[model samples]
Target: MIERKKYMSLLEKWRDKKVIKVVTGVRRCGKSSLLRMFREKLSDNGVEERQILEFNFEDLSNEPFLDYHVLYSHIRKNLCGDRMNYIFFDEIQMVENFQKVVDSLFLLDNVDLYVTGSNAYLLSGEIATLLTGRYVEIKLFPFSFAEYIEALPDGTPHDTAYRHFSEKGGFPYTVQIANDDEMLREYLTGLYNTIVLKDVVARRKITDVMMLESIVRFLADNIGNLSVIKRISDAMTSQGRKVSVHTVENYISALSDSYIFYPVYRYDAKGKQLLKTGQKYYLVDTGLRNIINGTKGGDLGHILENIVFLELARRGGEIYVGKVDNAEIDFIVIKGEAREYYQISLSVRDENTMQRELAPLQAIQDYYPKYLLTLDNDPVVLHNGIKQMYVIDWLLQN
Candidate 1:
């Protein structure tokens, strides 16, 4: 397994702390793997096996312990000594009213708890009220380009590695079948269906499964395009499927809550405020997008943009699409007092394309590292202090 140092470092910091460590992401994004890796680390560090109690609710063996009382009793009965007992629960959302069990276990003096879930419901709604400020969320993603490269066999050429990484995406399972296109596609399709059927449709009790699929396809086809619920409703109605704007809104929320698609709101760069109407949605992983929407040659620009969007999020930046005057910037990332502007494209090889990509950043008067990233081969153009970089180089470096 690739060492997910970023997430492991976070878990190490929160080790034995009073707060619950809540790991969240979409299905099969490697939450359980990370927890298992952390368990191995703890054992290597002299923590005894008996001191750690781990349960995955998805496992058939754990079905008997799904009841809150049974789970609580199991943990309570297994307390080995006065030393801290680390409890790792995978897919805690599978258990109904799990917050009560967690709340009850939290009262124990010897327990240091960690839980993983596929949806935000574990932290929002009623659970939020129950665990108010008592949990720290560690959001996990499939794999960063850096981590993806590390997972591959040693000494693979960077170009070949990058092509495979972008095409196959960072899902760990995909790495196992990277060389087999048909097998990888089948795996991704099955994974996508599970997320839709189990995470969104079944969980929300959405009756219109066809409508949900339509909305997902629309978002995948129009990645990074400004979207509104009414517009989506109208589009679906035109296709002989009538869906209310309200229903569209609810479905969109459900998709986002499942971590299938992320919504990035527009920000007025000059006004320093978020614009509500022209919000854009990006997929959590481009591999799923490509599989669901059918791989298209024309969508490379959007694919690169999606990759950059996920990279920004993984780097802990608060990202927004920027509108500066009549021009739009692809990304405006604000992390702490550091702000960076980015415009992503397939290439700025042509004169008109170069100016179009640079216009928005040139219009901005700030000096906070504006970048125009593309696929150009190191043709450095330093226009008014804005640095133009090759996208692959930037991804590998940062």
Candidate 2:
């Protein structure tokens, strides 16, 4: 496995810290592999095997230990009192009342704990209230463009690599099956279905599978477009799905909780406040979008915007869609008190497109750095003050 250096670095930094390291992400985004990699790191750094305890509740063999009492007893009995003990739990939500196990384990001064879960259910209810600030959540994602480049065979052209990456997406397993179109489609389809069925459907106890799927398809098709729950509900109803606004909100919430889609709220750049309505959602991975929409998903501009959103997310910041007066800035990334504005487009080679994209960024006063990213192959240029860059080059940047 290509080491997930970004997340690995986080795990390494938090090693032996008092807080429980909770790794969360969408299924198939490699949370389990990341934990395993960190396990190796610990061993290589002189942590003895006897001092580490790793449990993956998803395995059938672990069924015997599914009871929190049995699992806690087994782990507690294995603790090495002479030295620090490292405990890693994969899919901790699979165990009944796992929060109690985590709380009990946290009380033990001898162990440094880590856990991974596919959805937000792992941290809600009793666990959220009990743990409070005792845990540090490290959210994970599929490969960044830099990692995507590293995963490809040595010496592939950058343009070719990015094209394939954009089409097939960054799921680690894709590195192995990308050459086989049929296999790639089947894998993504199965994974998407599993996420919807296991995480979204099962957790929410949702009955309308067809409506749930329709919602997924709608979100996949409308990435980067500003939408509200009522609009989505009305559209689906008109199409005969007949879902209530409350039901649509619940379904979308479950999807977000599963890490399959992210809803970015709109910020009033002029008023410096978050708006109550008009926000957008972007899928976790473009490959899943491709699988769900099939050949009908053609708008490359929105797809490119979707890619940039994921990239910004990996870089770590609060991202929002910015509306300054009537103009819409593609993204506003705020880190602490500072903010960076961005506009994404397929190309601004046409003067009209260039002006349309530039108008929003220019409207914002107080320079926090603005950029216009496009797929066009060109040297970096400045439009007034906004930096115009080749989107591929931007994605490959550290």
Best by TM-score: 2
**Candidate 2 residue spans exceeding 4 A from truth:** none
- Candidate 2 lowest-lDDT run of ten: 295-304
Model 1 agreement with the true structure over 208-285: per-residue lDDT tens digits: 898999999999999989898889999999999999999999999999999999999899998888997878999999
Clashing pairs in 1: none
lDDT tens per residue, model 2, 24-54: 9999899999999899989999999999998
State how far residue 16 of model 1 sits from its true place (Å).
Answer: 1.4
Cα shift from native, residue 159, model 1 (Å): 2.6
